[model samples]
Target: MKHLFLTALLAVAMPAWADAVDTLKRFVQEVRSGQAAFTQTVTSPDGAKKRVTQGRFEFARPGRFRFEYDKPFEQLIVADGQKVWLYDPDLHQVTVRAMDQALGATPAALLAGGSLEKDFRLAPAEASDGLQWVEAVPRDKDSQFRTVRVGFRDQALAALEILDNFGQKSVLQFSQVQSNVAVPAERFRFTPPAGADVLEQ
Candidate 1:
């Protein structure tokens, strides 16, 4: 009789505990076994501001990642736990920065840290404008973006919408996501060509 009562109480309390913030935290941990291969689409601002590139991503824990753009151009961004390298073969340019400083207020930090509860306040995922939205506001103003709205279907991450200070919105939709794959060691490391200009930004 006591077991039955406890089970019923827990069932009633479970949904309340599975809040937006908690869900994000759980998802991060679920994907943290080491690596993932996901595609990203970055849409530039309005009026044909720039090219929309589709890219493949490889990510490993403890600050390592690779972004390889495919369409429009071939470019790569790699972070090897200590330094970040952005290389564009067409432009023959390489940009390097310290990893910690480069990740300032970026979504990668949230994904890599699994610390959503520390950085964000959660509200209900709303349905407005004929779309589903989960609103998340950063706890710190220093965060690069003002808000991150994760769109969902059946509680899976369907899309991520980021709003910057200028009110510009960048939305990323992830497809064909394979989590916990064994990423190659070379993907996270970068070597610039001898003649390419290396700018420290």
Candidate 2:
């Protein structure tokens, strides 16, 4: 759980420009569920290397997602609509928080039924790497990220670049994104392991 709040916020982004808005609406209506493999690189705002984590993710819309970290550490974050459970296997600890508190104005809430115009000040960015990009700055003063960029390839979500307040950036690139796929119900259901410490925030 390197950056728990920050990780929860890497959900989505969109700008009000015609093309960007169209892309967001199309995704909201069609790409309701997905699973993908990801490579995430975290760097200092000054371009210094922090760490890299690779993992697979499975998510369902309207507020359900799970992240499984497999490299550099083993951890998991699961949201069962109402609550979010973060498990740090190496520490034998689990942290739980209500969905509203955990997601705030993060990208997770955006993809899970939030509207860009309502929650973020979206700005269109010049297209790059065959993807249309939008920068999102949260309307909430207390958001975990300073700004986030969402990239879409042909209206399909491709990656997220998150800049935390302290000048650290984490980039998550998704590949093998399968939409409308079946993800087992139990994926978002978490039970703390025996002897693990549980902290409720």
Best by lDDT: 2
What are the RMSDs of all candidates, in order?
7.0, 6.9
Candidate 2 clashing pairs? 11-107, 11-108, 12-107
Per-model TM-score on C-alpha atoms = 0.74, 0.87
- Tens digits of per-residue lDDT, candidate 1, 1-201, equal 000011345436654323444455555677652433344444444534533566776677767877787776888988888898999999999999998788744666555542455556655454543444556677777766787776544445556677776666666666666667777888788989989999997
Q: Give the TM-score of candidate 1.
A: 0.74
User: Could you give me the TM-score of model 2 versus the true structure?
Assistant: 0.87
* lDDT score, candidate 2: 0.78
Expressed as tens digits, the lDDT of each residue in 118-176 for candidate 2 is: 66877666678888777778888878888888888877788888888899988899999
Looking at model 1, the pairs that clash are none
